[model samples]
Target: MSLLSKIAEIEAEMARTQKNKATNYHLGLLKAKLAKLKQQLISGSSGKGGGGGTDGFDVTKTGDARVGLVGFPSVGKSTLLNKLTGTYSEVAAYEFTTLTCVPGVFKYKGAKIQLLDLPGIIEGAKDGKGRGRQVIGVARTCSLILIVLDVMKPLTHKRIIEKEVEGFGIRLNKKPPNITITKKDKGGIIITTTQPLKKIDDETIKSICHEYRISNAQIQIRCQATADDLIDVIEGNRVYVPCIYVLNKIDQITIEELDILSKCPHYVPISAHHEWNLDGLIEKIWQYLDLVRIYTKPKGQIPDYNAPVILKSAETRVEHFCLRIHKTLLAQFKHALVWGKSVKHNPQKVGKEHVLQDEDVVQIIKR
Candidate 1:
């Protein structure tokens, strides 16, 4: 049978199977088989006219961070890009208006954020339908994703879009599972867990592993994860990204409806054409980006507040700061004098290994 046919058969079987302790192992095996077939389909190993390469857009990465605008056609993605970055993306009332990826840049909190207006993706995007792979390929490179949805449309569109993205190995607003698997030479499957396993059992884990052709290995579970989580860990190619659901055309909705929509987490309501609640969107973007702004101070001179060195929150060390300024700065640097919440006292002498906080001022002392 064809890979797609095989995949469909397994899916059908999985759907037919009842969910209970008696069927967990069988369901896990089916999931593993489905994941393997999908991977093969994506890589074009199925030999059924699948493209081996991702025909992604040829957009150069610029600025300190990148964000992507993704959604169905004519859902204000183009409008959002144009208004936010003052870049034209050919807005229209018809579907599939933006054919290619349109990139725009804007500065916020001393950091330049690059936003890409991607082509609208339809259902079955994960299976390479409607420029889906190309759009998702660009989205995978983004630091954050803005899923633009029309408030007038059914909210079911959100779930459909999310499923499409997830099928392409993108885990939106999720963390990696705290499960670890190590392959061993001859030992049998060794299972260890720091916490109790409630969602998945030992047999199901083994069944999934066996389907993946893993025989001798040690598995460690640190969290209460489900069968899907175990499968994700086995696949090992998932990308966990932050996503914001941009509910556009809120101007057409009633005030009471808007209030109800506002209660949803990670959702921002706005009228892209009217420029409503845009400041709130920007604020939320800044918060999710988790950027650090470090000011440079020359010896016996005031800190330069006009421009600050921007760094990601995870890479806010003094060494990273120096590298951002200049590669040679680290070679000549002895230490840094930091003045911020990161330091106990103002203007504390610290080494290059010291981590910096947002809006911190620093003076470098040469060796």
Candidate 2:
């Protein structure tokens, strides 16, 4: 059967479990996961060659913007989710506390984004330990992944975390994941960052080098003042959606560690339970989500902001929306009345060739 069908099967089982008194975290995770799977299938990525893109799943079609929190257990993925969405995920001082996926929604300037806190994964997570296939599947389904790291001493966990993330990326269609260095407490000088240096041991580095050959993309970054999210955003990488990195538990990081973190790009320091700079995090994420509020009205009616208006990308056109509404609209489409300055849709009678702009209301007249 097609991958879509397979995803449907899983979704059906999940629905049953959810109705049969399943846990909210698990139900939420399964539902969100099914949504992602359906999206990939709709975009034609369900082909046999597995997912095809470095940015998690390869969606050749219009896909939702999904942000996932990824890290080993106790690194604060759940805590961050709790703080960001008020989900009240069980937080503890140990590993493997989060056994299931937790999904929550966050709003930034009227745009709602899906935030996922996946179960904690460890070394060889993709190989079978700790439900590796499931966890890897969760991360693989995301459009973007937020890697969290503890900015503490020893540097062993840091290296392990980075290595594991990169390694897992390699295993899943050679996708390149965004990194987030999370710091807990304060003590050391400052962390330093340099362009991501390939550790030779990291297969992602080798795979990326082999794939791109000459193109250069840095990997590592130290937390800094200007850093509020992932390196792709901090370094001005042309990204489809914006990403933010939270260095949780800033109270645990030392000044010396801060010096090291400052080497790459500066990230935001936050305490998940204390509401420290949480709004800043929300604003930054909202800005990157590319959310637009569009108003809609039928015929000669006043634009109703409360109406269910379709939200799409800034560049999405009327024809694109037409297909979404109905495939036959593309063929039977006549002229449409446009409000606001959509450039393509604003003027007199426009055909399917019209492109839509943010907040532009439209009325289509077809035979």
Model number with the top lDDT: 1
Best by TM-score: 1
- The estimated TM-scores of all candidates read 0.95, 0.55
Instruction: Please report, in order, the local distance difference test score of every candidate based on alpha carbons.
Output: 0.89, 0.54
lDDT (tens digit, per residue) of candidate 2 on 137-196 = 556556556666554532465455444443333221122244433333443222335444
Which residue runs of candidate 1 sit more than 4 Å off their true CA positions?
45-56
Worst 10 residues of 2 by lDDT: 225-234
Q: Model 1 over residues 243-283: C-alpha lDDT tens digits?
A: 99999999999999999999999999999999999999999
**After superposition, which runs of candidate 2 have C-alpha atoms over 4 Å from their true positions?**
1-64, 151-159, 169-243, 253-266, 291-293, 306-315, 324-332, 344-349
